[model samples]
Target: MQGHGYAPPPPKRPSTGALVVLRVIFVAVPILSIGFLAWVAPLRAAIVTHRRADWWIFGGSLVVLGISFAYLSTDHTDDFSSPNGNVGMIILLLNAAACVGHYLYADIRHYHRLYPMVYLPPQAPAANYVYPQPPSPYAATHPQTPVTPPAPAPHTPAPHTPVPPPPQRPAPARIDQVRAELDELSDYLRKRDGHYDGGRDGR
Candidate 1:
């Protein structure tokens, strides 16, 4: 049984078809760069990977090769017009062109396959669409169109309500006592002012 702290080791790097293709190209760089990209010419995937400097190197090699082929193809004036030399010269020039053209466009996809960090499938571009911009309050679009006033909501007629008069309070049972207290207050006021007004005056 495995221990509780035991953790499985990380997975090893995966083998890709691109890595296999690169191996084939490297091997054939001597005799003939053949394989899927070579024999299947006209239609080919990137076979060999190249660094930025590799392009210049390939270009220089092509120039040197072209010059060499041209020199060999030239007549020494001894057989300048012979059919045999002419055919060989044509063949050399054609081969040089083909080599240059093939190397010029060799596959650029390599690091992705060789290194684990760089091999991600190409992300498809996000679908593009002009989303309707939210309307801005500062810029009103329909200033000319008059806004019709909303019709006043119909007013419901209030029902006629007869408010009953407040209930009549029962006559006070202490009316007599209240009147006696009032007469006493009136007499005390009259004595203080030295002006007496008999009850008969208001009666």
Candidate 2:
């Protein structure tokens, strides 16, 4: 007679607490970073003239928080571990990377936009300068000519042209030499006395 086999139990669901914590972290890290950036700007202005450190600190903290949240979100089950759990972790890491990247981009853009403005010397306004009156139609029609014709100047030799750079040569292969050196080393090592005498020496 054929015997019936017992069926396996259903998979266990994740704890509500773990899910709640994971969701909270997912939403909080970005929001916190934005808030920190906003708060630090004014504090930096009051404390330190240069606030690069503040921005960096805020960005780094957000990244750390994101990573911590991602780790906390990782849940492994005995019977049925969610394949998509790692996806959430990857997305969190990606978000952290994006935050850091955006911070760097903004910092760089800010410096680029401000650098020229800061370094450029202010221009002086022209003072006591009278605008030239437009020439009359008669004067414009008949232009004055020079009395004596100017002599042709002597020509000078052209400046030397730069020579083109030589093409780069490929580096020589040292693999053979390295192999020979390794073989020599192996030979030296093989020649050394063995500590264990072929399992013959008694301790």
Candidate 3:
């Protein structure tokens, strides 16, 4: 049977060099990290850990970054003097905010938190500590009555003499014999009463 208590191994943590590279990329090119690396690293934790909130937070940040980028590109240039420019600038600022949020959440919160938890060696049990055994879920609630085995059945002595077979009942007469007898009786009765007809008898 599959065990409910057993947990599969945690997802592998990123290496020191890889983690360093990731942090550098996130700091140097926040947009690149927000757009792509976010999916690669931060979002992966949400998937591996089956954390729905992380999925939404990381995924939503990426989406916001994407939408703002696309919006700013189409006739929304970075010219703060004009009206479209102001709106575009606001979008860029929002996008930057989203990128920062993503970096903090993914790199700082999840990366640091998840790595140590997953990669750290298991701690040895203390010498004096006694592990408490969990109570069995299948334990009986009430004291059970002791079950007594039934007494050995008494033995019967076999008969010394050969037993005779049961009397066989004679089988009833066959249909043809029964019909012949009925016809004879009928003819005798009919002749006695002066009603006998020999035509049926081929006489």
What order do candidates take by TM-score, descending? 3, 2, 1
Q: Write the per-residue lDDT of candidate 1 for residues 1-203, one digit (tens) a residue.
A: 96699689865654668656654554354235322122222123332443554455455544544554465465565654566446545554454445435543453234445454756798866676566898776667545667899999999999999999999865676787788899999999878665435544566
Candidate 3 similarity to native, TM-score: 0.36
Return the clash pairs for model 3, or none. none
For residues 78-118, could you state the per-residue lDDT of candidate 2 as single tens digits?
42246545554455555555554454444445444544334
- Model 1 segments more than 4 A misplaced: 1-17, 25-30, 33-50, 75-203
Top candidate, metric TM-score? 3
* Model 3 per-residue lDDT tens digits across residues 1-203: 96688788998877879867766655455455433333444354455456677677667756765665565566534454555545655665555555556555655566667765546788887997898998765665765688999999999998799889999765566767888999999998878666335554556
Local accuracy by lDDT, each model: 0.52, 0.54, 0.62
Better of 2 and 3 by lDDT: 3
Per-prediction TM-score to the true structure, in the order listed: 0.24, 0.24, 0.36
Worst lDDT run of 10 residues, candidate 3, spans: 33-42
Clashes of each: 1, 0, 0
Q: Give candidates' CA RMSD values in order.
A: 27.2, 41.1, 18.1
